[model samples]
Target: MLSLTDVDKVYLTENEAVQAVSSINLTVENGEFVSFIGPSGCGKTTVLSLIAGLFNPTSGKILMDNKEITGPTEKTGYMLQEDYLFPWLTIQKNIELGLIITNLYNEQTKKDAMTLLSDLGLDDKANAFPSELSGGMRQRAALVRMLAPKPSLLLLDEPFSALDYQTKLKLEDLVFSTLKQQNKTAILVTHDLSEAIAMSDRIFLFSSRPGTIYRVFDVPAEFKDKLPLEVRNDPNFHLFFQTVWKELEKVENQNSNTS
Candidate 1:
C-alpha cells in the first residue's frame, strides 16, 4: 500500500519560494490504479514526483508499505510523455537496460522481458532501433523496459499524451490490462478527463495553485473489470465524465478568477 500524510512541497528559486502542493493526504491500496487531474500548474506532476521519491516533501511523509520514500527505489518505476529510449540502442537492449541497472539481469530476466515484448507485439522489433519504430511502438518498448524491473508501483506521467487518438486508446487498453494481470499499483498524472475516467479506479481532482485534493471520484464498480476502450463505450462512462467535468470546470474557473 502507498500512503501520503499531510504532504507539502515547496520550491525555492532565486526570486522566491513557491508552494507546489499542500496538505495532501491519500492512500492507494495494493494493485489499485489512481489518476491525478486538474488545471495546469496545479502541481499534479509535483505530487507524482514526490510519490516517485524523485525528491523529498518539505513537510509530512510518503510511505510505501510502511517505509518512507526518501529517494528513487527499485520498488517504483516511472514512465513519461516521451519514451526516452536511447536512439542508438536496439529495442532488446533498451528492454534489458533497466534490469542491468538494477542488477536484475540474468537469463531468466531476459526471458521474462522478451515475453513481455512479445505480449505487447514488439518481439519482432527487438533488433530495431528507436528511429525505426513509430511513436506508439517506441512507447510500448518503453513500457516493456519499465516493467522489466518488476516494480510494484508505477508512476505514469502522461505516457499516452503524445500519441494519436486511436493509438492512445489502444495503448490505454493494453496498459490497463497488462498492469491488472501483473497486479501492479499505478499512479497516473493525466490532463485528459475521459482517459482518467476510463483507466482509473479513482480520480484525484486538485485545486488550483498550491494544490490540494479538491475531491476524489471513485469509479463505478461496474466499470472496474472493463478495459479502457470498453469503459469509454459504456453508458455509465459519460455520466461519470460529466460529473468530473463539472468539477474540473470549477477548478479551471477558479484558477482564472484568482489569476
Candidate 2:
C-alpha cells in the first residue's frame, strides 16, 4: 500500500550538500510488517521521515495507496524510541490526545480508545501519570495512544530499544499480535537483528550512508504464523539470524574500509 520510487534525500549545508539516502525504491504491501536494519547513519530514519511527510525528498516520490504523500496525514501513526507522553496528563487523556487533535473525539471513539487501553492491560493505569508508570507500561500506553487514532500505517522507530530484554520481548509479542489482529501495515526501524528477524515478514538491509537497499531478506514461511516470541524458538530462527548478521557485518566492514 506504500511505495517509494527512486527517492533521494540531500541536505544542503553552507559548504556542500550531503546525500542521506540514494535511489531508494521499495514497496510495502497492505498489512505487511517490514523492518529496515542497517549500520548507523544509513538513513533508515530519514526514509521514515520522508514516508511520514515530515521532510520532502530531493528527488522521486512516496505514495500511500497511490496518493503522493506531501505532508503529514492522519492516516499514519509514528511511535518513537521514547514514549513522549505528557507527564501531567493521565493515561486516559494521553491516549485520547490524538483523537482530540484530529477532531475525532466523541463518546464512541473515547470508548473504543479505552477498550484498546484495556486490551493492552493498562485499564487500571488509565488514571496514572507517565512518571508513575514503568518504562514498559509507558511504552504500552504509547502504543494505545498511537492506535487510538486508528492509523492505517505505523512507523516504529526503535520503539523497544530502551526497554530491558524481557520487556522488549514481551512488547514485541503484544505489538505483533495487535497489529495482525487489526491488519495494520507497519514499518519498523531497528538495529536489533534478532528482533527484526522475529517480527518482520520481510527485512530490508540498507548500505552505509547515502544508504540504498543492499539486500532484502524474506522471513521464512514457517515463522509467519507465529508471534514474535514464538518465532524465536523455531528451529530455523538462529539460521536466519546468522545470515542477516553476516550481511550486516559486511555492511559495517564496508563502511569502515570506506571511511
lDDT of each: 0.95, 0.94
TM agreement with the true structure for every prediction: 0.99, 0.98
lDDT of 1 by residue, 44-111 (tens): 99999999889999999899999999999889999999899999899999988999998999999999
Runs of candidate 1 with Cα error greater than 4 angstroms are: none
For model 2, state the Cα shift of residue 86 in Å.
Answer: 0.7
Candidate 1 RMSD to the real structure:
0.7
The runs of at least 3 residues in candidate 2 whose Cα sits more than 4 Å from the true structure, single-residue gaps closed, are none
True-structure lDDT of candidate 1: 0.95
Worst 10 residues of 1 by lDDT: 235-244
